[model samples]
Target chain A: MADQSQPPLTRIQQKNRDLILEGALSVFSVNGFRGATIDQIADAAGLSKPNVLYYFASKDDIHKTLLTTLLDMWLAPMIRIDPDGDPLEEVMTYVRAKLEMSRRFPRESRLFAYEILQGAPHLTEILGGGLRQIVDRAATILQGWMDDGRLAPVEPRHLIFSIWALTQHYADFEVQVRAVLGPGHDPFVEAGPFLDNLYRKILGL
Target chain B: MADQSQPPLTRIQQKNRDLILEGALSVFSVNGFRGATIDQIADAAGLSKPNVLYYFASKDDIHKTLLTTLLDMWLAPMIRIDPDGDPLEEVMTYVRAKLEMSRRFPRESRLFAYEILQGAPHLTEILGGGLRQIVDRAATILQGWMDDGRLAPVEPRHLIFSIWALTQHYADFEVQVRAVLGPGHDPFVEAGPFLDNLYRKILGL
Candidate 1:
């Protein structure tokens, strides 16, 4: 095992870490944090348990790393909502970005869902800290838009919540979506226009 | 231990079954299916493992029972959408019912979310059968509303999905909601008007 005080990871160490994280994402997304195990993650990563432990001290450590990384990526789009952009366009762009994330990074979305579903035991601090900060900033921008009559006045926080709920549902609840849509139905392909119309109508744009 | 082929449960047996199911909901909702154990359920129920087993065949059996029971309750609101009522009223009623379910049956909502996140391994048949039937019938009603220009023309199915996403987000993501809103924020109370305005605006009511 590598020493706790060791220098920066060599190239090989970095690669192994990535592998472990990728495997952990799949296992944790499907099985949830409590359901997942180091052994399962190790097996998925094609590494020995000790080898997995070498990079991350414990299952919790690995989970923490994964969650922090995910939170950053998950919040990136919201952070990118340009304050100076046309209000409707900014909001729509954020919606599409969120929907695209749902389609492309479904496992990541599900992982976050799993954490939230269980009351966010591991993420309470981040949720209260980084997440709160970013969301507050974004909500202010949305409020500004409403004040300018650029969008229909609504609860900024709740409006953001609505956008998350609508887009992430396609990924987090993929099975139900597919089951209802039946075979050969790609939800995202249709979701784009469907969501655009709904938001446009709601915002009175 | 009670025999598998025994006659109907006595009053004592009925009481024990209720205790076990109630306990199972707490454990299973927190831990998800794979993470939950019979011992945990038994402990929660204040029963011996053998006694718990006597009442239910296995963990799968217990989960299946919980899921089917939940499905019925979950779909009851959709089933109540009146075909002959004012289209907007019918739709909003369904929305309110679903939101009420989110507030009143949060554990059940999270339980269903857990199942769906893992690909609905335990609920495929029900989703395709009962759920599909009700949603399809509701979609037809929504389509009728659109046909009469009582509601804006949109994909009825996606609209229903949107409602579920919005309402359920308050429940399933309760932790995030609470974390972001901080103390003194009751999402359900505010959610009622927030969602009502959203649907009213979207439906052009």
Candidate 2:
């Protein structure tokens, strides 16, 4: 059956779907797309297979729902990177916000990583419409910063790419990172100074 | 039966194992550990189920062998980064080598991505023994560069992490990158100059 309940669903459907998505995030983040099974997701969700199927038509349907929902939240911070703000400050804010998300929502980050690693088979449209357009707009803003001498001349797209790589590394490679940083090193402590220096040095204001 | 052939395997044995590994990489890279099947890999290698099992005891064995082999090759260039060389040049050479590998051996890159993405389930020991040790030595070399002011002051470990993230992003997130860059764009062409400027600016020599 379709989700007949509207945007703000009745308490029961809301609770059930929320539970399923939360459980699904954990399972999907670790096992990845092809690796995740409906049974695992159902078990993790504490719902029977038929009960899960009652909400989502199939495994692919559940995955698409999670991914599209993720895309909305994932694009929010970048959308908040105001084109009108101080270039350095705006970009630095974006960097810090992204890193904070990596620390706080590592599961979501890994889930995204798993999908992208598997080639975004279920997300070509979202990638095209949502992510691609936002990146283009951000690139245009970055180019303006370069032209205005508000930031050092760097490839706008690559600048965005570097920002992403530097921030996300903390989450995506946490195992390797923590191992090298040593026990109790706390990546966030180093992350602040490291990012501060990176932005300062790169922007060259 | 195990791989009973001695170190000096007959040409047929060598070729057969190589074929199986090639097939295994494709399956493993596209699908994470839990998602891949012995049937698919065996079929890809042109061997019956039992014939494939003769070469590799189980699917896990095949996956482990593939990752172990990749780890050896993956760490080669870093091991070759001469500490005695000019710091910028040494780092640059390492960067170029990694990027080149991303282009040439993309499947290996993707295979490694899949493993790490899944928490490095089978290769944690290798990470500690092989990868961590090499990173330690590499970090020391980078520290020397920083102490001598041959390279800008940055955390050696994080610098290495940055390089890995930036270079690997091209191969691991190829779909998203290509999608945004558009149909006509060649990522490597733009990537080369972007990275050259990046390290140069970051090192600030």
Candidate 3:
């Protein structure tokens, strides 16, 4: 989404952009795309509306830019699964990595969830094309493990879906998860062994 | 949330209320609470804004009424897991029931997801009180099963969280799930055996 034709941003420019994006994420994640406004983003970013607009053309531009960056970050965990490595360890690593991300980056997780909950109007192209391609590649690798009997034979895509569902819920549904788990308990820690057991069983480890 | 002191609604009153709620669900589920408007609900319900106002005191009223009803319906599935029933069967029944609800009531699923995504501002009392109580009871039942070795030993609360995460993702992230699966495949059908395997393993059947 970066314009190659433009000159590289100076550090000050880059910092301002990051500030705006961070603020925009706060607004967009909680208020959602339709609900968020430039004024709100500007206020959150500690900039004037004109300054925020000076950085991005419009609210849609900010959202699309945020999602573009997010999809890449989202994919990095999946891409960490090394096909050449031992299958169960690799899968658990991926699962743990996802859980860690949920713990660390809940706001980003909610931003993505909010997008899909509203039908991914800003993200359809990436979800259907780039996202699906990475998932298909991962499926192929998972199926290869199954074919060799290194993992349990299950539909690879649904397995992928399950991994995503199990991990992201910690972030996207943090409020409910925390409320239900009650006080003084860490959800990610509690989730660790259970996810390990299920994945290990599913992988035939 | 129903007013016990109020007289029962006539058939016409009930029908109109249903229409407004249905229309509100369509709007609120898609646009979320901060984004939705009474005018939009009025248009979706085929009533004037004044008429929509006459039935519900405000947009907040419509959303609260809808979510209050949704919580009861949501609890019904968990309540169906009879404690005296075979623990594994009861758990699977609850799992399938949740998945089926995701398939049959995606809008409702997303509405609930959106509410939680935005911090459960309207549903906090229920989440902290009523909802937690039912989940605690189920957790107690699950723990009893584990103590008897009728199910696998794991944190019952985390196991319940896994069930919700895996099933609701189908509805909450339907757009992404459909895009990844591509054309023609029924997600619920594909998800059935996969979830069955998971429950079977987690329950140590």
Candidate 3 lDDT by residue in tens digits, A59-96: 89999999988888978989878899998888899999
Order the numbered candidates by TM-score, best leading. Answer: 3, 1, 2
True contacts kept of each: 0.85, 0.68, 0.86
Off by over 4 Å in 2: A1-8, B1-7
Docking class of 3: high
Candidate 3 residue spans exceeding 4 A from truth: A1-4, B1-4
How does each model score on TM-score? Answer: 0.95, 0.95, 0.97
Check candidate 1 and list the clashing pairs. Answer: none
Clash count for each candidate, listed in order shown = 0, 0, 0
DockQ per candidate, 2 decimals: 0.81, 0.72, 0.84
Ranking of models by DockQ: 3, 1, 2
Deviation of model 3 at A191, angstroms: 1.1
lDDT at B194, model 3: 90
- Per residue, candidate 1 scores C-alpha lDDT tens digits across B1-205 of 4668968889999999999999999988887898789999999999999999999999999999999877888899898988889888888898899999999988899899999998899888888987898899999989998989999889999999999999999999999998888889899998999999988888864
Candidate 2 per-residue lDDT, tens place, A1-205, comes to: 4877767678889899988888889888888878888889989999998999998898888888998888778778888988899899898899988899888888888888888878888888877777889999999998998899889988887787777777777888787777677787888768877887877788876
Q: Give the TM-score of candidate 2.
A: 0.95
Which lDDT value does model 3 have at A76?
98
